[model samples]
Target chain A: MIPGTPNTVALGIGAALGLTLAVAILVLIRRDHLYIRQALWWVAVAAVALAVGVFPAGMDYVGRALGILYPPMLAAVIAIVAMLIKILLQDVAITRQERQIRRLAQELAMRAESPSSKDIS
Target chain B: MQDTLIVIPAKNEAATISGVIAEVRAATSLPLLLVDDGSADDTAKIARAAGAIVLTPPLHLGAWGAIQTGLRYALERDYRRVVTLDADGQHEARWIPDLLAVLDGDAADLAIGAFPERGSAARQVAWALFRRITGLGFEDLTSGFRAYNAKAIALLAGEEATLLDYQDVGVLLLARSAKLRIVEVPVKMRLRTTGPSRIFSSWWVVTKYMLETVLLCFAHWNRTGRQRT
Candidate 1:
């Protein structure tokens, strides 16, 4: 247990929630609903959650060692940073998709403009 | 004159498309292409009826995307020059020749027809801020009525332009980075007849636009190696 660890009830709750989320993600992957590349990151996120849930005391210890006054707040800080990084990754993907969409739109517009292609359509 | 193409990106412009088409046709014998931009209204039908070749994207790509579509078409068709104007009847079509003159004069690779006395106070302030930040001065940096040569067209229609968020300042910054000459010619413009200015409608919009544009400018600047002053 951590030096000033919260009750075991909270850790148990966190473990349940984390496992549930992790299973949900795995189910999505199994059904082929999510792309492997994207799912991999989410799976890692779930792993992080599970790790924290299983070892909540470690978080408190790490937080104190890192000079954080309130160790519990560390989870929130890590969650926020993780969220920000995920957003940045999504933005990069969006930029790629935007470029492709524009190119496709332009190509389709061009095909319609051509007289021979117009006849085919 | 024949080598030039006028591209107007229109969406839901049923009310004013016909008038603008007729005016541009009457003003010059130049071929006109109205990018329909996936308007649910009769934009494509009206433009076709008015005698402008209508090109519609598969989906609604905003004004800038539509403009880029037109630019790509011009590049493919081997046009020497391109003049782009608004379909809202806000930008006058008669000044088309002046923009062309700048292109022909070798004065600049791109000619932007700016209106010093036009636009609202909020828009003016936003433009002023843009000018100060980018160190690019023009009375109407956001003017849609502009002329571009083939070289400028290729640069903007290429992959780099995909990163651009908006056309006006984005296009200018791209041109500037390419070391292309940019000159702004004073052109007459009337206030928009219909709808609101999306970027300058409110303080929040203007702030957001500025932030996005500035971030994009720095992004492009660093990518292009601060190619020019």
Candidate 2:
């Protein structure tokens, strides 16, 4: 016995789309074109999208709780929020590294300008 | 190379830096190490004239970054103790010895000059919120007046500290996480010789600072596995 789905065709399409996205991400990572650190987040997002597509009932339950008539719209909303958070975290990380690199450069310059450098000994 | 070194981190404090340097000189005859954090003014020239060895970073890296630079310099020179204060003349140099006394007492690896009545209802409330969240018992969370031993200097000068935006809360959390003792001594801080406090300059800045600090606290808490969740 199996549970019923309102639209099996749409669910199948969503699952296929998510699987394709995950595969593409993996291929990019394997080819060394993409950093694993960043690609992992996309992979997780793809996995979640696939699960929601396969077992749409979970999202349907959530959409109904949130009073959204359409479940696919809910998936889209979740995907947007996830992407925004990923972008924000990356921005913070990059900003921090920028400061670090600048400081390192300055420290090196200061060391160079000092005539009586300690490293010479 | 010295037993005790006073490291001051300055940025665009040309107005009152010479006075601050003279104050430090009056208090102790120890070596003065001034880290100029890319000030556009004549801060480097003034500091040099005041007899402080000035090390100017090629670019602006903010207070914490400058302090880290000074700490690394101290570590390289093998200073046993280091005292750091603001260059805006807000932090009194006379309190330096008191802070060092705490380090000498073997009670703390780091000592902070804390003012319990640094007064501002909003500021107190913010400190209260952080106290409740981080469970850190320091009265002054934003004080730049602090003293550090070799261990604290080594830890702060490393890669782990480079990512921090603010020195106060982040440094406290890092020191506590490393099981290093942090002590506080009662000290009076004067009004800023320059303009208003940068942290409280605008509502938007305050909101952004709060958001970043809360995120940092959560990240550290998770890494330390201190939370039950």
Candidate 3:
């Protein structure tokens, strides 16, 4: 019973597709590979949204299958997935930098202590 | 004469230290002062046994720190010139004579030994970057094998030497700021015998070293500029 005339459905699909393409283009231009991955995920979500919005029956079927309480629940799920992936990737990068710092510190300390004694003699 | 003294900074290099000491001893009878930078092994004992007057720091100072300590010691003992040599078996002892010859013939304040072949690709890249940033024409800025006359040694004996993590490049920069004459002599460098390189293990290590070296160069440039003005 959500108001869905042909004109309104076309407008909704057009807006979503336009926004997705614009965001993907911006992300790609930024050259951050991680952001590009997120943009792609967002584009897929928008595509799905456009498809379901144009077909009211399809939206109702998906909502019912997922037991989604509201029409926007699917969009929320997509956003959460994207956020989790970003956080995981950031954590991995930070851990790698920390490991490199630790190794360098250890090597510097060892080099300082034993001064290539055998070679000098 | 009493114008030059050789300072060899040694750590735990007992096996090759004797041969190196013998070679240097035979090459030139220049009074040798060895700084034993807290070696866990018999490095200090062996160096002393080999007729090198040894000075042991309270704790283990890194290569630069040990070299600085040696410089300070020479400064205190009234030595006019100091030739620094690596305790590692890599640097040929024969090069010491050549470095000294350059210092004497040219009346150079600072004489650096340039290695013909520095094996590692990462090291080559790092050296290239250093040369690009510092604009100093010396091929091997990191080589510890060099001779410093009193003028150059005095410039480096200041408080800045204690703060330096790497002395070779920093000292050279300091010499330039002090208007001391600098010269580079070609010397064949061999691979290090004791342990693996602390830097240049992988791409990540190379990146880290490059970052540190770049920062150090910037720091030296700023300091030198400030001193000049």
lDDT of 1 by residue, B100-178 (tens): 9998989899999988687777677778877777777777888889999988999988988865656688888788878
lDDT, residue B91, model 1 = 81
* DockQ class, candidate 1: acceptable
The DockQ assigned to candidate 3 is: 0.02
lDDT of 2 at A82: 83
- Tens digit of per-residue lDDT, candidate 3, span B41-139: 887778777777776766556677667766766777688889888877677777887888877786687888888487577677777877777766678
Give the C-alpha miss distance for residue A99 in model 2, angstroms: 6.1
User: How far does residue B162 in candidate 3 sit from its true spot (Å)?
Assistant: 1.3
True contacts kept of each: 0.51, 0.21, 0.00
Preferred candidate (TM-score higher): 1 or 3: 1
TM-score each candidate.
Answer: 0.81, 0.72, 0.61
lDDT of 3 by residue, A1-121 (tens): 4553346656677567656665666666477654665576556665665565456556546776888877456756765887798789878877675444433443443334333443442
Q: What value does the interface RMSD of model 1 take?
A: 5.0
In model 1, the clashing pairs are: none
lDDT tens digits by residue: candidate 2, B93-203: 999999999999888999999986865888898888877678788899988899999889889878888777667888898988888899889999997767877688799
TM (chain A) per model: 0.86, 0.69, 0.46
How are the candidates ranked when ordered by DockQ, highest leading?
Answer: 1, 2, 3
lDDT for residue B134 in candidate 2, whole number 0-100: 80
Docking quality band of candidate 3, CAPRI definitions = incorrect
Top model number, TM-score: 1
